[model samples]
Target: MESIFHEKQEGSLCAQHCLNNLLQGEYFSPVELSSIAHQLDEEERMRMAEGGVQTEEYRTFLQQPSGNMDDSGFFSIQVISNALGVWGLEIILFNSREYQQLRIDPIHEKAFICNYKEHWFTVRKLGQQWFNLNSLLTGPELISDTYLALFLAQLQQEGYSIFVIRGNLPDCEADQILRIMRVEQQQRPKLIGEDEAQRMSVQPVSDTPVPGDEAPLDEDEEELRKALALSRQHMEVEDEEADLRRAIQLSMQGSSDPTSPNAVVTAGSSHESGSSEETLTAEELRRRRQAYFDRQQQAHDSSTAGEVKDSGTKPNQ
Candidate 1:
């Protein structure tokens, strides 16, 4: 099996990354596909903005050669299928949400595109073992079927979907070639050490744990648990801070006293016939809050730039 990462392009080109991994050493590159997709997307957006009619022919635009590779960061199943078709490979797509057993040959090479929270990663199965080629990771990591299923289930709950990709071999020669490749992979030397072996092993967790029963955690497992907890805590703190900032901004807009610390005034408000202590309407308050935040953001950005400039300038040392 082969694996590749999008590196700096992971955030916007995950679909392209997966495609590159699947079509390594091909004439076409992921960069080319991305460029083509972006151009088509821009054209389509322009047409839609001009109130272009959606006829049956318009619906099939994606099937046309000019628009086949077009996408907006994420590739639809049709886009992926059409791209693969260019290389003479037929795509067989399966949705993970559908409750149907996949009929696949264990020995044949296959690539699985797993989606979680709009991020994509590739996976492959060899016999009973599964390997994950997540772009963020250093390399392929061994994973368990139970872990894969649980991960997919959590993603589905968050409104994400998974798609499995299987390409049809062109002829018997291609099938034999893949079988040989699999045999070579199986014959590769085993390099798992004690730490790696521990990491690859999956410990089952029961729904109900008996009192006073707990399994000992390995060093790696303990560190991972601590990291996850710290990350969750940091996210919760950020959410609270954002909510508090929004509340303060809104409160400033609603204050009636012009002299109050939280008072906000729009243009021409002071020239109105109403008294200085007049409360604003909900719509006016919202607009004022938005303007206040915009000003605050600009000020913050200016201060940050000045700080950066000062830091960059060396003191007389």
Candidate 2:
């Protein structure tokens, strides 16, 4: 994980992260991708001009925003394709007829780029194994060979468009070592803000609870406060919101059975947790909120500790 290059999410710049992760380096940036988008926009404008720049259609097109890029740092698939073309790599849609005809399994591919809504991510094979190199996660998630096909199927079910990366990938250390002596993961990585929730869920019974709250907080309350304050400097809220939406969706699925005994969830919070109020208890909702903040706290602490060690005031642990 340490050897693999990964860029955490910043604003809505996932397209940039997706490209770099696919190539296994800082091979792309928001500025570079934006340039690609602008070039694409220029090409499109040229085509529209062929249709006659003096026409109403061309006039309207000039007034509209760039279809290839947005103010929030989003770049369209066209921009992503162009950027990969620069690296001599190409993308093949996983669900395309041409891809289906090839009968190539997910693990057989070198890398994948997935898009759901506007968020972009990479799942690439390094060494002899597959990894979900999503920037929304705390670290690279090791994927077993047997599970790779199932994973891609699940993503498609979730409305993600998966593209297989084709061509020679630039060499990197993680791939070389893993090709020889492979490493085994004792635990899987969680979504970036999910670790604290897991820890809180399994605390010993002796852990103290926050006053006036049903969920246990113990020292977690302090951590949350620290995290909330540090967020301006250390984290982006977009990815946390995405995780929250996912958790709520899972909760809704669990509570979908109206006939089930546990189906009655509280109404207001249910809007955010999922449509079914019965899905997440108010206690669970608080815990999920805690998880979001706990993520920020961890990132902030890690950064601060690094600065301290660099100053020679603290030894590297």
Highest-scoring model, lDDT? 2
- For model 1, how does the per-residue alpha-carbon lDDT over 176-292 read when each residue is reduced to its tens digit? 344445322222222113244455355455677645554566674454334222111101112223333333333322233422333443322233566234344434543544565
| lDDT by residue for model 2 (1-317), tens | 68887877787898988888878899887888888888899999999999998999999999999989999998999999999898798998877767666766566789989887777889899999888887776677777775465355445534467788999989998898788877777666655545566665576665566443344455743443343221112222333365454443343233433223343334333455555433455346436556776887888889998899888896657
lDDT of each: 0.44, 0.69
Question: lDDT for model 1, on a 0 to 1 scale?
Answer: 0.44
TM-score of model 2 (CA atoms): 0.63
| Model 2 lDDT, residue 241, Cα | 61
